[model samples]
Target: MKTSFSSEFAKRYGLYALVTGASEGIGRCFAEELAKAGVNVVLVARREDLLHTLATHLEGTYGVLCPVIGADLASPEQVEDVFQITDQIDVGLIVCNAGFGTAGNFLDGDIDTELNMLSLNCVAVTRMVHHFGLKFKHKGRGGVVLLSSIVATQGVARSAHYAATKAYIQSLGEGLQQEWHGSGVDLLIVAPGPVETGFAKRSNIQLGKSESPDVIARQSLKALGRQKVIRPGVLAKVLSLALSTAPRWLRIKIMSSIMGSMTKQLPQ
Candidate 1:
């Protein structure tokens, strides 16, 4: 299904958008959606081959410019490299969708992997936001899409650190939304539930009911300037509503149980 955006979206955000993690999954979907809107895209990811293939498809199909930047955001040096290239481009929109998650006990997880996750999910996001946030504000028009998860709302046992990272994004996006309210820089935090993406395989977790990446991407773009936070897709909305009134302690336990189920199949 093709996602369509209003002319106002392109007008407000301008010609170019940069999507981190655009090699695959939700990031790829975001890239497709933006390209469908006739916005030129700069695709950023570690896999240069995948990025090139995707760039070809997007450019061929959507007839929009797709510049591929291959860099691991987990590395500080690589992030700097990305900045050097993007600095030359007038990117009016940035989708900070490059992040991974870990499953199983926090203590059981590898220290290196957890640290890497912290760097990519929290640190990299902050850097991008700080750099582009200022640029957008100065220009008085831009858009920022932060991909958070429903797990961000509370602590989950098997996915503690992963959830914590998303919490950081959730808090940051919410704060920036209010801080940049009148600055003509729109900030949207998309807290989606389980999505049908490569995350399940890489994270070594089994999803229950999940939403399509397209649904998440389409809905998020549509809500970019209209709202501060959005729980896109039916699964996300249902989960949010079901847990909204629960006590914090209850939310934690419930989420823990759900996470446990998803990760239970992992080798113990």
Candidate 2:
């Protein structure tokens, strides 16, 4: 008999999953999906109220145990505390999905904000992967989902720092997937395009067409173990392919045009 993806995930990765940035967007969807598959989850985010609300909903709807942890991933002390808080919970799967973006000209953008973005998107992610990866390696079973973005393939003009950080994640995930192969652990990097989330508003960018977060989350889970890297939607896949196949000069010009439009939407 063939096993379902959700059940296979639960079985191979164990019964508990920890999701960062679990208060909203794709992170929240991941928690709900895992709960539906009978996996207890530890929800980590900066907004305690939102996390608790989500925990309550998941517990009530799916009958799964959901623990909430409020932590700012950008802060070293808080990121360290996340592991300490979850020390007792046997987290078999980790979705290091906590990250943010910024838009506008690199020179015009606040330097501090960009650095903080790097800390959360790169440094914090590195720490989380290293800490949990060792545990998964020792056990010889578990999985990790690292979030990247379609913009990772090139230098996006207005969102330079954000794109760079995602590029770092993409490379990291690719290398880790190879390193963990045949070791009974799995790593998947999901590079999604624009989604209907708070990201656009926060980044002050005008996003074009976008898909629902639910679609991205579901596709991401199914792609796990099956693919090393995935661009969630058809549009994103097409864009990724085009970027890869296009000449460097053409790609840069195209992305620059897109970024110019997005930047125009930013408040003066």
Q: Give per-residue CA lDDT, model 2, range 88-188, as digits (tens).
A: 88899999998999988788889999999999999999999999999999999988999999888778787888989998999999889889989988899
- List model 1 lDDT by residue over 1-268, tens digit each: 2234535666798778999999989999999988888888999999999999999998899888999999999998998898899888889999999999999988888999999999999999999999898999999999999989999999988999999999999999989988998999999999999999999989989998889999999999889888889999999899899999999899999999999899987665
Best by TM-score: 1
Best by lDDT: 1
TM accuracy, model 2: 0.95
Error of 2 at 36 (Å): 1.4
For model 1, what is the C-alpha lDDT against the true structure?
0.91
Model 2: CA > 4 A from native? 1-7
TM-score of 1: 0.96
Segments in model 1 whose C-alpha atoms lie over 4 Å from true places: 1-7
